[model samples]
Target: MSPLSALKISLPLAALLLPLSSTLASPPLVDPPAVPIAYSLEEFRSAVRSGGPGKDGIPAIDNPRFQSAEQADGFLDDEDIVIGIYRHGEARAYPQRILVWHEIVNDEFAGEPVSITYCPLTGTALGFERGDTELGVSGKLVNSNLVMYDRATDSEWPQILGVAIDGPLSGKGLEEFRVFWTTWGQWKARHPDTEVLTDQTGYVRNYRRDPYGSYRPLRGYYHPDSRRLFPVMTDDERYPPKSMVLGVRTADGAIAIDKDALREEEVVDVSLNGSQYTVVHDPDLDTGWVFHNPDDIEIEASNLTFNAEGVSGSGLENLEAVNAFEAMWFAWAAFYPETAVYEGGEAL
Candidate 1:
């Protein structure tokens, strides 16, 4: 694996052009992982919004929290990002003594108070937002996979991908060894007659590794709900129209394909949420627009590119690489290369 390390691990968007400060850190954990569900940022944005909470308050990151860690930018440049604040509906674990030296923070979790920035090196998690300018030359290094993002629009969602635990007990504070390794993963799926006690030396064989979520495991955003849902395309094979909501528009530059079957006052002068868009329908590369709100999918085309060439990121067709626990579904070949959808049981 050395064609420049296979093009630096096949450019996963070149890990978003690095420089949030040089990145490449990990070293902490002699015991970390113990707040299994205590949240309170409006229930972490109503549990990442499958929609359900919000009584008021909790969602801040107005600036100057971009990682100097809780505040101590003495040099080794701070940036840990990957925080949580969710209260009930489960999701509470900060144990590496607050992810060791405060990595990154925008805050809030599960009850749906979103933004969880964490990038352990290309493992990717632009899921939340709040701040930063990058690294190198002039000696700068912010790098904070200490997660927490999206304070209303920088879009963030990376939880655990790189730097699982970096260094000889980096700062020590393993809350009862991360709540006994997450109650032993909810006691091995609600106790399959329980047994795995593992000769306890602060038991660290497989770590917390997703105590719930049925089985998801771990990666960037923690993918699993069909990779975060969204990929409905067709033009006529047997049905040709399932639709959950897919739109596309761009005036003068010519590229308008809204068609959610058409209707929004018959498309007269359509304007959806402050315009400036780029929504290319990828009907079948396994799955594409399920980003209910990647800040409302925009790309005012200044060459906002994404020619998946042969395609991937796991919209699942032939498939080759997709590790955020897979989320994609682009198929587009049932027959509509230009247009065709009658479905009234055949009409020549």
Candidate 2:
């Protein structure tokens, strides 16, 4: 771990320092599996608290522009964190530095409208199908996660829950797609033709600095043992508050796998709601891929390839891919208090 520096700022103050702006757009909705939540819609809404800047306080990228990977090399360092997605022959990278300023990016993936959201406080980045709507930061937070609102109905959708807790669309869930939390070099190496989001985001702050903390060497609020900026609905001490976990949720349940454990074991088999699943570690990308293995297929990992009966693929191919994303342990626990957690290839 790297030593703390003057760059660190009090999180409460950090929230107040965020740039504020509001957009008239709203996020779209779809009928995907509702995220399993132990709390009622009322409880989620009741827990919501002002996260410093008010609605649109943290502006979202509406008209996103991109540059080729080679052009991005001028600003991006190899270890810089980026949220990546590949779909319909289009691969794009959204740098964390830019997202740290704008929590949401209303973007289109191969003609399919989607919203890429990141919660700096919770250390989560997720992509959701928006259809014709655009999501904006509600400037409200529950469990220290970003709460989003759609312009269409003015409903509140917490980024992690992916469900509206208030407004006419309350209880509605949004369709989601997979977004990889990996480094700049890792994403570019895998998708050479990837387009990188440019810092040309209309609103500008110091894009080089992260107000929350640093992910490169892990310090400030991002430190595994750092204290949370706000109180969560539920708290679990089983893992460090900021520790990263690859989490998956269904309409019935939720589960999380410790990233460190997945890295060590390479492959970890687990069960969710009576269905078998497997999490495979991709060393090259330094991320995990979760697959719904209903038949309990026996999987073997040799180097970067995973082999199973009637399945053979390098990294994340030839499997029923599940939409999962990396989240901070505290945030995951807060929303899904009953989530089963696994570490070291064993349930903990």
Best by TM-score: 2
lDDT of 2 by residue, 100-182 (tens): 99989999977888999999999899998886668889899999999998766678889999988999888888888888899
Model 2 earns a TM-score of 0.88
Candidate 2 Cα outliers beyond 4 Å, as residue runs = 1-32, 303-319
List where candidate 1 sits over 4 angstroms from the true fold. Answer: 1-208, 215-270, 274-278, 283-285, 289-348
| RMSD over all Cα atoms, model 2 | 8.3
TM-score of each: 0.19, 0.88
Could you give the C-alpha RMSD of every candidate to the true structure, in order shown? 22.5, 8.3
